[model samples]
Structure formats: C-alpha cells, structure tokens
Target: MLGKTVKVVAKPRRGTRGAVSPRAARMVLAGAVLAGAVAGCGDEPIKMGAAAVVGDDRITTAKVDRAVLDCEKQFKADQVANQVRTALENQRQQQPTSGEPADCSARSAIDTMLNIEVAAAAAKAAGVSVSESQVDRMIGLMSQQAPAESIVVALGMPKQFTRDVARMNATQGLILQRLGADGNAQSPATLQAQQQALALFRQTAGKLDIKINPRFGSFDANRMTVTPITTRLSATESGVR
Candidate 1:
C-alpha cells in the first residue's frame, strides 16, 4: 500500500531471493531508522534474524527462497512480460514513489506472502476459522476461474503458496459469514464485522512485533503491506483485512 513517506526512495533493484540484498539495504538512505520504526504500535521492535517474525511465528529466509523458486516455476519471462510491465506501472504511480520495479523478477511475490501471513494472524485472532475441507472447496471454486498456479501468479505470488493463501482467504470469508455478511453487499452487519476484524488485525499487529528484513522493505502500517525503505517513510498504525 502506498502511503506517506518521510523520504522518497531511489531506484529499486531485484534481490536474488525476492528482496533487496542486505548490501542494497544499507545503500538505501535512512535504512536504520526505518528498520524497526514501525514494528509495533508501541511495543519493543522485533529483532531481525529470519525474514520476519510474526507473533510467535517466524517467517524464515528459507521459506522465501522456496517461494522464489516456485515463482520461477510458475511463469517464464515472456509469459508474464506484459503483466510485469503493468505491475511496475502500478508501482510507479505511488504517492512518494518507491522507485522502479524489477524487470524480470519475483520480488513482489514476497509482498503477497507478507500480506497473507499478517492477514492469517489477524484472522486467527478474530476467531475466524475455515476447515481444511472449506479451504479445499474454496480452492475448487477459485480454480474454476483459472488454474490455481496462474491465479497465484496473477496475484504476484508463488504457485506453491496458493493453498495457504487460499486457506487465509477462506478464513477471512468465514468472518463475514459469521456476521451474516455473505451475499449481503451493503448489510450493516457486514460493515460492522469488517470494521471489527480490521480492529483486531491492528491490535494483533501491535503485539506481533513484526520485524521485516530491511532488504525487502519496511511495513506500511496504513496498507499492512511492506514498502521498500528506500526512503524515510512516516509509517503509522495499520493492518491487513
């Protein structure tokens, strides 16, 4: 999510594992300040080791590497050429632009993973649940729209990561279902539940003490997504619904 930045970022480069290298992390101006600046609402920042730490869970660099390899398996350079262009164009329109996008990269895949992890954590906190069967059913429904792998790639995620993300989405849906929000586009109950879920998400984020590698980016509280800390951004409290 694009939001206010304390400083604008310079151009971006792709990291081998779908993030900027630590060396590049150092190159980015104001890297140290942004590292743990927005890790928690007021709690102590998480110490970096793996890619990030969400609550008691650790999202490791090894997982990220596996995802990078999965993304490579999903599509070839020519297949996603136009889509990559469009994605970059979208990133280009950011308010305090976070620099250029990688030409032939799976970097954005990491963002999808980060968002899913945060959303899953929040959903668990909100008492949202989806059985494995429910997840499978949702997967079937979504696959009817397109191949599962293709859909994941379309969302800038690794094909191998689809099942978990699908489960997360299903859990989010369960929240709406519990509120009787499903099939009621403009229901007050739906809106209230959505609001409540967001609140829970923010609360969870506050206590999660998430620490992302400065290489990939800093978390944008407003959008609940990671933004490259190429600049000194003014991050605020936020969550992913």
Candidate 2:
C-alpha cells in the first residue's frame, strides 16, 4: 500500500534470493507514493515478501514489509470501524470463522504499486524525468477529483489527506508529464498528450520481470512462498444442507 514515507526497509542486492536492491526500493517508493496512498484495511494480516525483479531493478523484501505495515495501519484507521458494524449484521448467521480474509481492494493497491514501480524504472531507462510544473498539474487534478472534505473524512485527518494527496498527485503528474514529452505519441499538439499516455501505457508494461506465486492468488509478481490450509468436516457435521 502506498502512503506517507514512514520508514524504508532497505537491503543489499543478493544473488540467491530475489529481494530488491536498495536503489530500486527508493525509486519504487517514490512512484508508489504517487500512485496509491495506503488506506490501511485488512483481516488475517497476510504477510508477503517482494523479490520480483524489473530488468536490473529488484523489488526488495523491505518494500513488502513496509507495504504490509502501511496496509495494516490503514485497515485499522479507515476500514476497521465500518467492518465491525457490518460484521454485527451477520452475527446471527452461521459463518466461517477465520482471522482476516484477503482484501481485494488492498490487492488492487499492490497492483498499482507494481505498475508505478515498473513504469518509473522504464521511464528512467528512457532518460525521462518529471518537472515541478508537471507535479503541480497532477495535484490540481487530484484536488478536483477528491474534494478536501471527503478526503479528510475518509482519512480521519484533514491535513493528512491534503498533504499525502498532494505528494501522490505531484509524483504521478511528473511521470505522466515525462511520458508526454518523450515523443512516445505521434499526434498534433492538441492531441499529443492523450497519445503519449497511450503509448507509454502500451510500451512500458512488458518491460518488468514478474514471477507469480500461486499461494497468494492469481497474480504473484514475486513468487513468494505459501502454504495451503484445509479442514474437512465429519459426516455428522456435514449433514445434508
């Protein structure tokens, strides 16, 4: 989950394991911050490791650790109260009991983070960079999309929402701005911006090195380890429904 930079867990490059290089962590974090700030909600508290490589860059374990922490924090801060209320409604029904179930929304956040990381790496390789003006433009767009009051209530803090959103918008803006200037698109000046975005979207995606781990679900970029759990009911417990 992307959020404010609380702390970074940086590790050196290793040969045996697929952990990320420290430099890549910095770049990925910068991009992730721009893409999706963590909202912190989940149950079962799944732990994951990042070892996927993007060309020469690695997506270190530290990044995964940080993401989990941020996700947990956001879960408590934003979703826990609402979830508690919902759970109460289902209390009367016989329900399966478990820790926290996997969060599809959080999974989407991880996907966004990976995309930003890979895109930032590709942009760097292409010698593209972002400008302050570009960041401002992104912030402007976010301000329009997420009104100050809604964000404040969503995040539980007015300043936190504004400041974090500003950072996310600015960083993402830089990426889009650079993509526009790289001549990735062929169009008249009026439509060049849209074309550039499309070109970048198509061109930069396949560049990353991803390995999926089946334990986590359908998409696994790092090939992290997993152990399946199974429980079978006895004949009496399994009486015809």
Candidate 3:
C-alpha cells in the first residue's frame, strides 16, 4: 500500500470563526484510512508482527517504525522539536514523573497509526469513505484556527495522518447517514447521527481487538483510540507469530 501514490492538492480552509474544538473533533473523527488495507474483517492472519490489530488486519510494527521515521523527518522539515519538547514537559509536569518528553512524537506517531486502523474498520462496516480533499480541508481548518495548539499537540504529522483523520471525519457523517440521520449540523438529526455513529465507533473498536506494543501505549476502548501508557507489556495481536 505504501508503494501506491496518492495525489494531494492545497485548498482554502474553512474560516476560523466556528466553535469546533480540535480535540472534540478528534473524538468525532480519528482512526481511519490506514486500516483500509485490510483484506477483510475479522480473524485474518497478521503475517508480520503487528504494532496493532484492528479486526482482521495487522498494523505492522515495521509500518509503525516507518511512520515514526517519517514523522521525525516531518519534524525536522518544520523545526518542531522545541514545540514538542515544551508540550512533553507540560504533560510531565501534570504527571510529575510520567510522559517522557522523548516519547511525545513517537506516541503521536503510534496513536495516529492506530486511529487509522479504527477508522478503516468503522468505515468499512458502514460502507463509507474519506478522500484526500476532505483530509486536507480538515487539517487546514484546524491549522488556520489553532496553529499554536496544532504545533504543540500534533507536531511532526505526516500528510497521511491527516488523510486518516479526514477519513474519520467523513466516516462519522456517513455512518450517521447510514443510520437514517440527516446531515444537518446541530439539528436533531445531526445530533442523533453523532450519538449513533459514536456508538458504532465504540462497537467497531471493540471488535478490532486492538493491541498496542507496550513500547508505544495501549488502546482505550472508551475513546476507541490509543492513549499514552508507560507500562511495558507484550504484543497481543491475534495472528502475530
């Protein structure tokens, strides 16, 4: 899949006057795109040792390693090291002993990869898809509205990571539509769709049996995404040898 090329183009972002919180948006649309490579849903072989397992597919550790390397490159591309260090320091301050600053970018890389897995699984089940334009626009919008926070919290993100978030964004609306809810924002129908799709995300994530290599973190089913965890553990994907 990494061998295939996908075209990307820049477009105008939505205005920054809206009320959508980026973290809330993360809740609404995270994990997607990467998991689209899975051949089918459930009980499939993970030929490579996996960094994560989402339903039938393996999010291979090799893939994660490559992603982390790419993210590191992206950081150097934009001089994000200082910002990342600061964010990690803040997180450490809150915990006083946990969340190593060195781990920040790595954790984000791994989390982004896992979210892509969740996204692909949920989108497949709902029969919806996300496009590059959607991803670009969403990332662009967040960047326009909250550049500081974006840099501090989500530094060194690859375009594919945003692309995955784009999928998650699209999947939420599509899942809502599939469940018979209209796409109107903030209306009753939209609310219903959001609620219903959130439930579907939970269900989808539960079925994926997602396992994180302890070196990275663990999956949080309530959020249907991976969260930072320092506790070391073994790889637990279903088909890994």
Worst 10 residues of 3 by lDDT: 1-10
TM-score comparison, 1 vs 2, better candidate? 1
lDDT of 3 by residue, 22-130 (tens): 3322222123222222212233334456666665666777776776776566555443333333444554466653322333255566555555566677788888877
Report model 3's TM-score to 2 decimal places.
Answer: 0.54
Model 1 lDDT tens row, 25-144? 212211111112224322234444456666677666677777776666565542332243344345457533354343213235555554566567766776776788987886776554
TM-score for predicted model 1 compared with the true structure: 0.62
TM-score of each: 0.62, 0.39, 0.54
Q: Per-residue alpha-carbon lDDT of model 2 for 184-237, expressed as tens digits?
A: 323353245544543453355444434322222233123211222122643234
Q: Residue 79 deviation, candidate 2, in Å?
A: 8.9
Worst lDDT window (10 residues) for model 2? 36-45
Which pairs clash (backbone N, Cα, C closer than 3 Å) in model 3? 31-115, 31-119, 32-116, 32-119, 55-208
What is the clash count for each candidate, in the order shown? 4, 11, 5
- Candidate 1 least-lDDT 10 residues: 26-35
